[model samples]
Target: MPDAPLTDLQMKQAAERFGTPLYAYSAAELDAALSRVQAAFGDARIWYAMKANPNLTLLRRMQSAGVGFECVSLGELARAVKVEADGDHLLVNGPAKSDEEYRLGGDLGATFIVDRLGEVALLPPASRVLVRVNPGLSVSTHDHLATGAAHSKFGVRPDQLPDVLAALRSGGHTLRGLHLHVGSAIRDAGDFAAAFARVAELHTLTGPLEVLDVGGGWGLGADLHGIAARAKEAAASFGAVLWVEPGRYLVAQAGVLLTRVMGHKQTGRDFTLLDAGMTELLRPMLYGAAHPVQALWEGEATTSDLAGPACESGDLLGHDVTLPAGAVRGDLLALLEAGAYGAAMSSTYLTRPRPAEVLWDGTQWVTMRRRETAEDIWAAEV
Candidate 1:
C-alpha cells in the first residue's frame, strides 16, 4: 500500500484550524468509491447503510450522490426522509419496531425487511416487506461482524423460514422477496460464491417474490476481486432484480482520522499518546480489526503506536504503527483508511471533547462538523 503522505501546508493548516483528534475526508475519495459501486452494481439499487455512520452530512452527501438509505430506526427513517430519500426506495431493516415507528416507516413508503411472524401481523396495512432469511451459512470476517450464523440474532433461521413463507401465504402482508445480510468485510471469492449459492437456493419462490436484496458487505480498498467475481456469478445465478447495501467498503478508504500527538511517554516500552482513544475510534476494541494507520509529514516517517488518552490500557489506535520518529506533541498524524466508523463512534467519555470533521474536495477542504465543546456535553445532560 502506498503511504498516504500529507502536504506540508495541509498538515500544518489542519492542525492550525481543526485541532487534534479531528476526522477528515476527501469528497473526491468518496466520490470515486461511490463511482466504483455504481459501476459494479450497474443498476442494482444501493441503499446507504445509515447505521454505519448517520451523520446528517454523510447521509445528505450520499443522497446527493444518487444513493438511497437502509434505515433501522425511527430516527434514521425520519432523517432519511428529511434528507429527501425517495419514498419508494427507503429500506427498513430491524428486529424491534414500535407500533408508532412501524406506521411511520410504512406511511413514509419505506420498504420493510421482516424477520418475525409477529411483524407480519403487526406491520401496518399496505406495507411491503422482504423476508430476511438465514441460509445456515457463515462468511469469513470478524466474529462480531458475522451475521449469517444460525445463532445470530439478525435473520430468520432455516427452520423458522417455512413460517415466513406460511405467513406470506396466509397473512395479508405483501411479501416482496428475500433480504439477506450475510457478513461484513468478506475477502474470498469462493467464500462469497458459497454464500451466494446457499441464498440463491431460496429463489424457488411460489408467490409474488420478485426482488432479491443481497445485502452488501463487500471489502473496499482491500480486494474487489472476490466480491466482483461473486457478484458477476450471482447476477447470473439469481436471475432476479438484485439490491446491495455497502457502507464501509464504499467510504472507508476515503477517510482519514487526523489526530495530533498529545505527548510521548516511555514506560516498560516506548509509546506515543494522542488525544484520541476507543471513544474516537472503537473498531479495534470492538472487533479487533486493524485499520491501515500512518503518520503523514512533509518528509520521512516511522512506525509508532497511536495511543488514545483514555484510561484503559486497551485504548490504542494502532499498535507498532508506522509514524514519523521525529513526531512530537502537536504534530499532525493522519490515521489513513478511516472513513466509515471513525467519527461516528466518538463520544464524550471522561468529558474529553470529541473533535471536528472536515471534507477535502481535492481542490479545497470544507469543515463539515465543528468540534464538540464542553457545554455540548453539559447541554445534553440537562
Candidate 2:
C-alpha cells in the first residue's frame, strides 16, 4: 500500500465532493501503521494515544484492532468510554489532572500516569498508577516538543520518583510501573538509547515492576526496531512488560488536509493562500512543522509559501512549497503527513466552520464527521 491513503485523483474527488479545507484519511494506512508497530514491538502492549487523532471512527478502528487508549483529558477518556473501552484497555495520563478526570478515570479503573509527586494524594483509593519520569536529557526535536527535558512541566524529576513511590504506597495505590516520553517527532536513535539508559538506572529503586512504558516519540521515519530493542532491554532490567503509547507515529502519514488554492499574492514572499490556516492545523505555526504540499494541477514548478485565510500574519501552513505555476484558484492541494494533530487541534477561530472529515475505505468514501455549521458553532453559547 502507498504511504499516503488518498491518491491524487481521490484527493480531487474528495475536494470536489466534500469541499475544501477538508480532512481525509485512509483506513488501510491506519491498519498498516499499527501492524508495523506490533511487528516491531513483538508482544508489547500498544496504547493508541488518542490525542493524535481522536475522531470517533478512528477510535472505533483502534478498538477493533485490540489497541488500548492513552488519554490525557476528560474528553479523551469519554471518547474511550464511548467506544466501550474496558479498564484494562485504558491509561489516563496528564501533568495536571482535574478532579472530574480522576473521578471518571478511577470509576473506569484505568491506569493513571501520575505526572508529579503531589498528584499521588489526589488519585482514587487503590488506583493503579505509573510514575512519569523526566530523564532530563536534551533530545533532537523542536524545543516545544521536548517534554523529557529537565525544565519541562511534563514528568517528575528522577530524584522525586522515590517520593512519588512512597506517596503511592501511603495512598494505597498500585504502582504499575514507570513512564518515560522524551519528546515527539524525534529522529535520533541515540536519544531513545540515552533515555532508556537513564530510566534503567532507576531499576534499583523501582525493583521488578509490572510495566515500563517508554512512551512513543518515534519520528515518522524513525527506526522502530532499534528503539524497541532499547525499550525491551530497559524493561528487562525491571522484569516489566513493555508498553508503548504511540500517537503521531501511527496516524501522521495516513491522513491529509485537502485545501484549495483560493488566491495568490506577493508580499516579499510568494504566497499561495488557502481556505485553511492556523485554526485548522496549528503545528506549522506552533512548532514550525512542515507538511509536504501536493498540487493537483500541472504546470511549470514554482516555489511559494502556503498561507491560510486566518487574519494573523503567522497563519502559514508551509514555506517554500513547490507547486505547478499553472495551479489556479479552486484547484486542490493535499497537505501530507497531517493525519495526526491536524483535525484534533482544529478550532472555529474566525467563525470558519471546522472542516469535514472523510475516510477512504479502499473502494468508497465514508463520512467520519460532517462539516460544522455556523449554528453548530454557536449552539453551546448563551
Candidate 3:
C-alpha cells in the first residue's frame, strides 16, 4: 500500500523525542516506493537523484535496493562512495563540471553526462558518456524547471550537437548514450512522449547507442505507465538500455515535516504561526509548491493561513488551509509530501537552526541527521 501520513501518536512521540519542526521519514514508505517504481519500469535502470534527499539512511536504503546513484556534485559522490555504492551503477551529471569533479567521476568509474563541450574536454580519453541534449521541447511544468527549452542553460543545444559530438570524439570521449531532462513536476504522458520522440531521433547521432537517458521529472500525479511505455518503445527501437533518474517520484511522499502551531492570531485573517519556515522547507517559497497539511486534534474545520517564523511575508507555508477549528498553541501539524525538495533546499536564513531528521522503520524511529547547531552554522566563517 502507498504510505500515508504518520499517526497522531507517532507524530507526538517524534516531537517529544526529537523536538518540533522535524523531518520524519518512513523506511517502509521508501521500500514501498522503490518496489512500485521497480515494478512500474521493469528492466529499466533507475538511478536515485540524491539531490532530493541525501540522508545517509536513505542512501543506504536505496543502495540496498540495487538503485544506482545519480550525483551532480563531488560531495554527493563522496556520500555514495561512503555507503559503498556500486561504482559502475553511478552516473555523474550536472550543468557545470569542474576539473576535480571530472577527475573524481573518472576515478570512481562512473559515467559522465556531458552537457557542454567543456564538460566533454574534461573527461578522460575514451570515457563512456551521455550528452544531455536540449531539444527545445517545453513541457507543462514551470519555465525555470523546464530544461529542454531553447533558452535553457541546462543541456547542449540541438544546433550544437554536431560540434559537440565532434569535440567529444576529438577529446577522446566516446558517446555511448543520449540524455534529456525537460523539467520537474511533470504529469502529462504526452510531454514525456514528446521528449522520448526527440530522443529516438537523436539516437541517429550515435552508432548503436548503449543507453537512452530519458531523464526524470516525474511527480506525484505523473502518468507513470504512459511514460514507461514511451521509453520502452523507444529503447526497443534502438535496442539500447533505458535509464531513468527519478529524484522526487520515489521519495517525495516518503517523508513529512512536523511542525507545531506556536500560536494563533486573527489579523483580518486567521493565522497559525509555525516555528518552521522556508528556512526549514523552501519549496513553498521557491516554487510556490503546495503540500497537504493537517492538524492533530479534532475540531470544527476552519480556513486558516499558515505562516512561518521567518521575517519575510513570503514565508507563508500555506494559504487558506483548513485546520481543526479553535486549534491553538502547541497543536502539532504535518506538511505532507515533503520528502523530495523540502529539507534538501533549506537554508540558514535568519540563522535559524535546521531541524533534526528521523526515520521510522515501521516499529521505531531512528535519527538520520542531528539538528543543526548555532556553532555549526557559524563554523565556516570562524
Best by TM-score: 2
Q: Which TM-score value belongs to model 3?
A: 0.96
- What does the lDDT come to for candidate 2? 0.92
Clashing pairs in 1: 302-323, 303-322, 303-323, 304-321
TM-scores, all candidates, are 0.92, 0.98, 0.96
Worst lDDT 10-window in candidate 3: 1-10
Summarize candidate 3's per-residue lDDT along 1-382 as a digit string, tens digits.
1234577788889998999799998887788778777777898999999999988888888887788999999899889889987668789999887777888888878888988877666786678888898888878877768888788898887678888889877877777778878889975768889888877776566657788888788877776877889988877767789888988988888889999988888888888999888898888877778788867878987788889998898988998997788776888888989999888888888888888999888899999989999898899993
> How many residue pairs of model 2 clash at the backbone?
0
lDDT for each residue of candidate 2 in 143-191, tens digit (9 for 90 to 100): 9999999879899888988889999998899999999999999979899
Best by lDDT: 2
* Candidate 1 off by > 4 Å: 5-8, 205-208, 222-229, 232-239, 298-303
Clashes of 3: 1
What CA RMSD would you report for each candidate?
2.3, 1.4, 1.8
Q: Candidate 2 at 261: error in angstroms?
A: 0.7
